[model samples]
Target: MFDIKKITVLGAGAMGNGIAQVSAQAGYQVIMQDITEEALQRGMATIRKSLDKMASKGKIAPEKVEETLSRINTAVDLEEAAKDADLVIEAVPEILDLKIEIYKRLDVVCKPEAIFGSNTSTLPITVLGAATKRPQQVCGIHFMNPVPVMPGVELIKGRLTSDEVMEVAVNYVKSIGREACLAVDYAGFIVSRLLDVVQNEACKLVMEGNAPEEIDKAMKLCANWPIGPCALMDLVGLDIVEHGLGTLENDLGPEYKAAPLLRQMVRAGELGRKTGRGFYEYNK
Candidate 1:
């Protein structure tokens, strides 16, 4: 594996900032970039809150919070963020054209040896890799939500990804204190593929007159699940689950489509915790 000292994370939303936090906590110099100053500041704020929370809970030393934050810098310019980084992880939304555009821009700005990884759980790694001149260095590094707390990350090898790049990704995952599970380049990868299906079915059950709380309670009480599907959907954002299901449907089959209730919830702008409502309500 090549030595990876600097990592650039594109996007400053939930997934983006979380990936940046973990990378910075792992002692990497991280550039967290977004299109606007406000977004960068928000991402940084979220990182600080998460680190401080961990320290308060005794999961990490109090001094580690500042140490981690010190390694992370914020930038609004894509070129400025990725120009000198050894690895660039794109954590933007699950939009195909937008991600393609970023990869193309990174190709122009990043060094030739830099590895490009996408945190997209629903998109195919091969398609994203083919967008740039250096497909061999492109792969999928799908980090789960609440990145600082998640201990598993999906590592995908694109069609043209080099073995060396995969090795470097494995080592990087380990450095960040997460286990890597290798998966094929496919829509919805592993975790999202399985989780979204369950969430979609939960929506259908809700449509069939089932109470969200009851479904969640049964799943937790009888199914041995840490969190029920209904509650998990709320945490993940209903819109994100809808989009992921749509991606799966396009790639897999009609059966993978999101249920009608899920579509209605997203259309109503009740996108779970982010928007303050979904199957359940939260204080925004």
Candidate 2:
């Protein structure tokens, strides 16, 4: 078994920061890396705020907040972050070329025994694995949005991923108090495909003249959904939801095409909570 004591998380966005936080909380030394010092600082700030919130709610001890934070370090240098990593989880944007570039660099910088994981929701893990020399050690560790709160994570196996790497991923997810659902290497895996279909349909409803608020309310009250699709899309960012739909359509079929409204909203830059608007408006 590969001992994963240190983890390097590339891309310090929401997903990256969340992964780093959970890994640190699970006792791993974590490095959260981004391309810029400003981004690194912002990601660290987000982690601190999240930890403090948990402490305030009594979900975690106050002292544990600092302890967990202490286990995490920030880095702007990819080589510096990857050099000693036992595991590297790339949570960067959903761009194939960009992810491949990172993997190529990681293959050179990380130890030969290090495992590479991508947190991609829709991209094929096999394609990503092929970007590195250690294809057998490349797999997917797809954590849901709001990673610290989501109980389930999808563990995807690439075409060349070894059982040993998959087992290590499963154990790591378990260590972070998350259940691992093994998925085959495919576009959108499982959850994202299903959810994207629902979210895409919800967008169509709005295009057909249904009120976004009413549609959301009906789904929440009648269907017992924790959140309505329109609202969920907003929470996920209209741009991201649109991108996922596009990937699915390209890989799966036209049935997964993003709704016109979704593309329009994304183009308009109303990217949900982060931008103060999407299906609904948010206070910035």
lDDT of 2 by residue, 1-284 (tens): 88999999999998999999999999999999999999999999999999999999999999999999999998989999999999999999999999999899999999999999999989999989999889999999999979889999999999999999999999999999999999998899999988998998888999999999999899999999999998898888888888888888888789888888888889899899999988788899
Error of 1 at 70 (Å): 1.7
Over 98-137, each residue of candidate 1 has an lDDT whose tens digit, in order, gives 9999999999999989999999988999999889999999
Mark the regions of model 2 whose C-alpha exceeds 4 Å error after superposition: none
For model 1 the TM-score comes to 0.94
Model 1 steric clash pairs: none
TM-score against truth, every candidate: 0.94, 0.94
